[model samples]
Every structure is written in structure tokens, then in C-alpha cells.
Target: MATTTDPRIAVLSAMAYPPYNETSESRCTPWAEAVKLLADYRAAVLREAADRLDESETLRDLTDDHMHDVNAAANELRRMASEETRPSDG
Candidate 1:
């Protein structure tokens, strides 16, 4: 749903996830640690967003336009994460 052009928003949306393990980074190297830090942040954001949705009780009333926006965001995040994990085709 999300286009390749919306990386920043996608990352922010992912950040809405919550209840992360902050100490997970201690077990890894500097680079891996950094990645974990970002992941935790994204998870926390997603969790918060999910909580908001639960509290609002408006998912059923969401307009088609809004749902499209959410789908786009979810897709963009998925694509970005996949690209990051993929090996270069040199």
C-alpha cells in the first residue's frame, strides 16, 4: 500500500509498536546494537498506535481514504525492511 517514496513516515509508523526489550542491544556489536535500538523504537511507536486505535473504537468508522493510507504505510514499511535485509546484487 505504501509507496517507496515514504520512508520517513513508514519508519515513524513502525515506531508506534511498544513493549520492547531495551536490553536486547547489550548482547550485540555496535552496528547490530544500533539496529536493535531503532527496532525497539519502531516497535514502541506501533504499540502506541495500536493502543490508540483500541481506545478510539473508530476502526469501523474509518473512511476508505484513511484505510488506504494505513495500508500504504504498512506496505512501505515492509518494503523498506525487506530492502535493508537483502544482500546487494553485485
Candidate 2:
């Protein structure tokens, strides 16, 4: 597996994910920090992909696919976070 040298990903790697109930960020749910970290990491991945456009086509394709998957995962987390705070109508 390829590794990233981006500092944002490194920061994310250094940050530990707290429990879903333990508040981590100000005025935000415990998992919000995690979601933000993931989103940041995904953004970094895309940026790196853009920078590496001169590389092989196979590598670019793989990176593009990876970026999409990361985006999907980040969006799913965003959806889950929104659902966590949504007022139930039932």
C-alpha cells in the first residue's frame, strides 16, 4: 500500500479517535472531530492526486478511485453526524 507524506494526514494519524459520547470539539459532538479529520485527510488526498498528474496513468486512475472512495466515506460520516443531531419526528 502507498503511504502519504502530507502533513494533514500525518496530523490525522497522530490524532486519536475518542469515543462517540466523549465531547472532543467545542460545541460539537464527540465524533465531529473525527469526521472533520477524515474530511481533511480526503481533501489532502485529492490535492496530492492533482499534484501527481504527471505520474503514470495507472497510478492516477488508482488515486482517483481512492479519492472517490474516501469522499464517499467522508460523506457517509457527514450523513451519520447529521442524523445524530437531527430531531426525530416519529
Candidate 3:
């Protein structure tokens, strides 16, 4: 089973696969590439978070504002990835 922290990467990997008995659209490559990039970035950010917590003397004492900032950054990355993969209504 995939860990919750990395589930998005797993989902993207699964979705990047070719469909059975059907041709894929040309635009799929860009979306797949974007997903892969986001997955890599997410993993890197998580690694950094773990490293920070490990090196900090008082992780338990982190302020709510700092936590919120971290969460917001992660959410922003998700939003950007979603935007890149979404089709525009043009």
C-alpha cells in the first residue's frame, strides 16, 4: 500500500499509463509530464520538512502560523499542478 503522504504521486503514476485497446490523445504527454514534475517536487518538499523537523530542537513548539505557512505552500503546489493539467475553455 502507498503511504498517505505520497498517494498523489502514486495516483499520477497510475493515470499516466496507456489505456487498454484505445489510442491516446496527443495532449496526454504534457499532462503526464506535469504530474511527474509535481510528484517529484512534492517528494522533495516532504523530504525537506522531515529534515527540518529532525534538525529542530523544538519541533513540538512550532507556532500555528508556521504550520499554516507550510500547509499553504503544499496546497499551492497542488493547485498549480491541477491547473497545468486541466484543459482550458478556449
Q: Pick the lDDT winner.
A: 3
Q: What's the TM for model 3? A: 0.34
Model 2's alpha-carbon lDDT is 0.50
- What lDDT does candidate 1 reach at residue 5? 31
| Alpha-carbon runs more than 4 Å astray in model 1 | 1-60, 88-90
Please tell me which model should have the higher lDDT, number 1 or number 3.
Answer: 3
Please, what is the TM-score per model? Answer: 0.35, 0.34, 0.34
lDDT ranking, best first: 3, 1, 2
Please, what are the lDDT tens digits per residue for candidate 1 over residues 1-90? 122334445444434533245677332234443464455445545545555544455664779898677656655665555555444443
Taking the tens digit of each residue's C-alpha lDDT, what string does model 3 give over 52-77?
Answer: 65456665467889866655665665
Ranking by TM-score: 1, 2, 3
Predicted structure 3: clash tally? 0
Model 2 residue runs over 4 Å out of place are 1-29, 54-90
Q: Model 3, which residues run further than 4 Å from truth?
A: 1-29, 60-90
The whole-model C-alpha lDDT of candidate 3 against the native structure comes to 0.54
Cα miss at 6, model 3 (Å)? Answer: 18
**In candidate 3, residue 64 scores what lDDT?**
83
- The 10 consecutive residues of candidate 1 with the worst lDDT sum are 1-10
* lDDT score for candidate 1 against the true structure: 0.51
